[model samples]
Target: MSMIKAHHLAVSYGHGEAALKVVKDVSFEVQKGETFGLVGESGCGKSTILGALAGRNKQWTGTLEIDGEEIGQKRTRSQLAKQQLVFQDPFGSIHPRHTIGRTLLEPLEIHGKDRRQERIEKVLTDVGLPLNFRYRYPHQLSGGQRQRVAIARALILEPKILLLDEPTSALDVSIQAEILNLLKDLREREQLTYILVSHDLAVVAHLCDRVAIMQSGGFVEVATRQQLLENTVEHPYTRILMDGSRGYVSERRKSDSAALPA
Candidate 1:
């Protein structure tokens, strides 16, 4: 079952002559329970596509269908609730002054969902957080814990799809792994679909089943995980990303080896 379908999706800022099209003609479909990735350098329109799908960016022209329904620029509460976005920075996205519980409660209140307390507890547990932690503010948590809360907030609505915008980028290297693992586990446990946007192929490889390589506002290639692992991607840009990732890994390995005492 296709959870999301988009075609000729162009998202822009401003209007008329001054309008800058950040995402050019791009199209893709994400299946249920699948993790689809958009991997590209910054300013390559990766987040723009996510914003368009999340209905945050209204200057878009395309045919977008979510869970078998065609979506317009404006969405109803129910339509908006069908998908949720997890931003790049947990510290920035989550309110510093708000308790985790209060933060989670805001969306449920807005959507007027019932059993709010039960939902909040369940989602916190789902994201590997203790129930009592909800009373704590974002400043009280570590980077990884804060991200788990962010994920918890996104999951509280019980949306079928999650739009992850560089979800682990702001964390420490070790914390990034923990968050990625948490996301992988959540996807299966919740039967959720994800559209992950990132610049790191390794991160995408960790969670994504398929990846779309974008450059200059459009997709250059969409390759499967197998192709990435086997180094069999046909597109030059895909190969470049793979090589770049490999080079980073190689450098990290060298650094680690150098730091090891004999």
Candidate 2:
């Protein structure tokens, strides 16, 4: 079943006549429990699409359906909780002044959910954080740890869909893999759906079952992971992205090889 369906989606900043469109006539479907990726260079409107899905941008116009129900700007609290967004920058997403426990409790409190302590502990464990870390503030945690808290906060509401906007782009290269692995495990355990946006083809290839290549505010091509791995993409833009990712991997491998002991 399609967990998310979007058609003719458009987003613009500013009013008419002065409006600058960022996403133009975009469309796609993400099946339940599937991770769909939007990949492109910066400013390609991938994040804008995520924002629209999360109801962050009311200026958007399109048909957006989540779990078969059409979504609008004025979403009910329950409807809003059905889809959660984990932002790219963990530092920016979390409240520096609030302890991790307080941060996680906010969502539950807003929804009037009981057993806050139990929920907080479970989400922390689910994100691989020690239960005591709940007393720490965002600034006290490492970048990776903060991101884990961010993921935990997003999951505390038990949202079925996650809109990941460049979720790992700001973390250390070594830490990125760990975060990705955690997300993969959590998705399987929770039966969650994902719409992940990123400029890194390698990240998308690792996490997404299918990917859409975006350029100039629209999707240039959409292909399954097998097609991407097999180099079966036909679009020039997608070809360029694939070639660039390959080049980066080759260079990084050579660098690692050169650094090895003789």
Candidate 3:
């Protein structure tokens, strides 16, 4: 069975004269522990699709089944916890006033009152944060540390699927590598399923198992990393986007994304 299934998923904002469809007829399924990527230029409805799946965009009309449970117009927190979204800006995702430790504990409080102290500590350490940093505020940590804290918060719930909206975009290249490595480690350890949305083909290739090229507002083609990097896709729009992003795909990083589609 699939972890997520969306059939003819369409999203729009406003109505009548002001209506604008963000994503039209988009369909795909993410299997257990599989990393499916959504790639295209900015404003191509990648983030919109992510929000719809998260049940944030109310104007959308579609069928979304997550882990065999259907999502109607509204889904409660317990229902939403089955799938979690990690936004592009880690700073925005986390509250600056709340310390790292408290932010991680809120989810536990919402779900149950018994408290899971051991679970919180394990997630914090697992995300590459040192024990001493637990009490620190968001501003006290560096960009990379803050991002790890965000990831730690998401993993605290132990969701079956993660919707990553450019999780590494706000960090530097080196820091991006660290976050990527951390994600890889967590994916293996937790056996998590990921639906990553990004404009960076390099990032998509490195983290995703299957590549879906979204153009305008719909997915034009879907293929493997080898097919994308090797310029093997025939879809005109996919070819164009690939050519535009070719400079980012130099020989230096080819070795890095080579083993990604596993």
Please provide TM-scores, in order, for all candidate models, with all chains considered together. 0.93, 0.93, 0.91
RMSD of each: 5.2, 5.2, 4.3
Tens digit of lDDT per residue, candidate 2, span 136-222?
889899999999999999999999999999999999999999999999999999999999998888899999999999998999999
lDDT, candidate 3, at 155: 82
Candidate 1 overall lDDT versus native: 0.91
Off by over 4 Å in 2: 248-262
The TM-score between candidate 2 and the true structure equals 0.93
**lDDT tens string, model 1, 72-155?**
988999999999999988889998889999999999999999999999999988888999998999998998999999999999
Clashes of 3: 0
> Model 3, range 1-262, lDDT digits (tens) per residue?
7999998999988889999998999888989999999998889899999889877887777688898988887888878788888888977888989988889889989988355788788888899888767788999988888889888888888898888999999999999999999898889999999999998888888989898889878988888877876667768787667656767577666666444442
Question: Which pairs of residues have clashing backbones in candidate 3?
Answer: none
| CA lDDT of every candidate | 0.91, 0.91, 0.85
Off by over 4 Å in 1: 248-262
Cα TM-score of candidate 1? 0.93
